[model samples]
Target: MTAMPEWMSPPRAEGWYAEDLDHLPEAPRHTELIDGALVFMTSPQRWWHGEVVTALTIALRQQAPEGWLVGREMTIRLDKRNRPEPDLLVTTTAYDPDRTWFAPEDVQLVVEVVSPESAHRDTTVKLRKYADAGIPHYWCIEDQAGAPVVHVYELDVPTGAYAPAGIFREVMKRPVPFEIELDLSTLTP
Candidate 1:
């Protein structure tokens, strides 16, 4: 028998899996599966979001150490039921060149640019997951009145959590993964 259409069918009550996502159409995207639930993303990201994501990706890529890969809107497999697509993330040398999703150990840092609907998850939910996975670093980027504000955190290994490292509104220069100099103002298109 032919398999039923996923995109057209009603939501699954059984929940979603990382593998199940692979069969869906690429266009008319929906939310990333989190803990097997179809959790929706915030309202569509405005143009500024793209500009900021692009700018941050470029700045991070230029300084990323050898063997590190910077990706945008890429999914990281935290577990069988949880797959989060961070806005931007830097993967370590462990990143498999042939793979689409990354393992926790393969990720050195995960950055999320907050949207009105995603602030809670980016700040609390994802923060906890990344910390528990021992991803090491997390950056929460928010655009306030057109200027990006960055909140940096470093993992407190003993606690399996992240400790606030810094809150940068303008010049974000820090030593995490590497020394990064990101100018928030430039991200606005």
Candidate 2:
């Protein structure tokens, strides 16, 4: 057996657990656990990013039914090792307001707003995680010329993956999960 080089060493402890995230000051804030691996986030990446996330979170919260919650940039524990902090997510069940993370089963929808540093992860990495966890809805919002463009997906039960539902630019009206009508222009502006 050969020893691994220092440059090739893992970022954190091997087979990281969700509870370990609680101890990292930057975690569940600027870090995430993906399949037992630690992934750092780009904080304050863009001013528009936070604004859009706030808009979507508010929209989802208003439409959420009783016992449901809309979380922003909070961790969702998909398993013992996979705790991903999505930009926005809707939980099917209400939280105690002090919980650190959510179970995958309670997450109905997950949203990600792409940034230059996280474009690949937001589109491919997190997309696969949410699909594997069987989240009913996923929305990928991209900023184009200071406007928000949304790409919607619905889980395909037979394949345990997501299928394209629709793409919205100026406005979005959806009935699944809950009734929501969001003005997309307001998100970036």
Clashing residue pairs in candidate 2 are none
Candidate 2, number of clashes: 0
Model 2 over residues 1-189: C-alpha lDDT tens digits? 988454333456666887777766643355788888878765657999989998788877777788888888888888778888889888877568788888888888899998888888889988888999888999999988889899999999999999989999999999987888898987766
Instruction: List candidate 1 segments past 4 Å from native.
Output: 1-14, 94-98
Residue-wise C-alpha lDDT for candidate 1, range 69-126, written one tens digit per residue:
8988878888877888899888765655566677789888999988888888999999
Record all residue pairs in model 1 with backbone atoms less than 3 Å apart, i.e. clashing. none
- lDDT score for residue 155 of model 1: 95
lDDT of 1: 0.82
